[model samples]
Target: MSHHSKAKQLLQQRDELDEKVKELLLVLETNNSTMDSPLVDAEGYPLNTIDVYAVRHARHDLICLRNDRAQWTEKIVEEMEQDEEKMGESAPIEEKPVHRTSNEPFVKVSSVVELSPADVGGFRKEDLIIQYGNLHHGNFKNMQQVAEITKEYENKTIRVTVIRDHRPVRLEISPKKWSGPGLLGCNIVPIAGANV
Candidate 1:
């Protein structure tokens, strides 16, 4: 099969895996449980309120599906890289001016509470926040600005851009009431010496 065809097939598989992960997450939510939530009581007995069996199964499935997705993603990337290499061999490359900006990442995500808005929005720990709604490295002043923005866009989706593993990932997060204390339920700290 061609590289393009392989990439397309991998992408479809990844999408299907994502859907399965979402379904498992819903099952966990229905049981009022997070991945780390204890299924047993203090005395080592299964909790009476939650369906421990279902939750355990959902969590296990989620883990497996996530691993599958990661492998699919790597395969897709490899296929795309091969395609790029083939194209580069046939065409002359044109150099474009690189625009360098001093706008560095201002805030770093320290933690994300499971099942919270941030978690649901795909926020991960150690993610460097380059943009949060209208706040960016150039205009961001402090954590207070982030708080204000979150309050202003309550229940509304806000575009968030973070650098994870040296790649930019964009996410839409809405601050809303949940089982967590804060809207985001994520801790962010300003980067030292970073322009805010």
Candidate 2:
């Protein structure tokens, strides 16, 4: 019962304080303050009308400054990243070139032998001439102008590169006339760019 009584008393005091505050608000709202000389609170605080507005405006300015600083910091970080990339490009680091096999002009030939009637039908393109019987490559191919290379190049050991069973191989081609019969009576299609 005593606690309840104390609570009631405190509630009544709060009611009185609320009523006084309401009256003060009504007077302030109407701009009616009866004070002499300088208005001061019990705590001796001089109330300046501009103080409230100034404090609020100052807080707004602080927030804008913080936002600007954040933007500036982001810009600075972006610039730094660009600068680092530029520095790396100024003197590019040289890398060791990949070790590679020599690319000689002539294809390598592994085998040399005589040609006969049986082998003439199986010839395809990309055959390398490792051996040219006795005639050199230039002399043999250019026989169109000399006509004697065919005679000199015949019966001589010549080598060629071929692909057999999906593997690269070197074979020999000799001077042999076509003796086997074919299904189609078509004109012979000679290989192109044969250095002839």
Candidate lDDT (C-alpha), each: 0.78, 0.36
Instruction: Write candidate 2's Cα lDDT for 56-119 as tens digits.
Output: 4444544454455434433433343344444453322442222112111122223222233215
Q: In terms of TM-score, how similar is model 1 to the real structure?
A: 0.48
lDDT score for candidate 2 against the true structure: 0.36
For candidate 2, list the clashing residue pairs, or say none: 128-161, 131-158, 131-159, 133-156
Shift in Å, residue 67, candidate 1:
34
Poorly placed runs, candidate 2 (over 4 Å) = 1-118, 126-149, 162-168, 178-196
Residue-by-residue lDDT tens digits, candidate 1, 37-68: 99999999999989999999999998888667
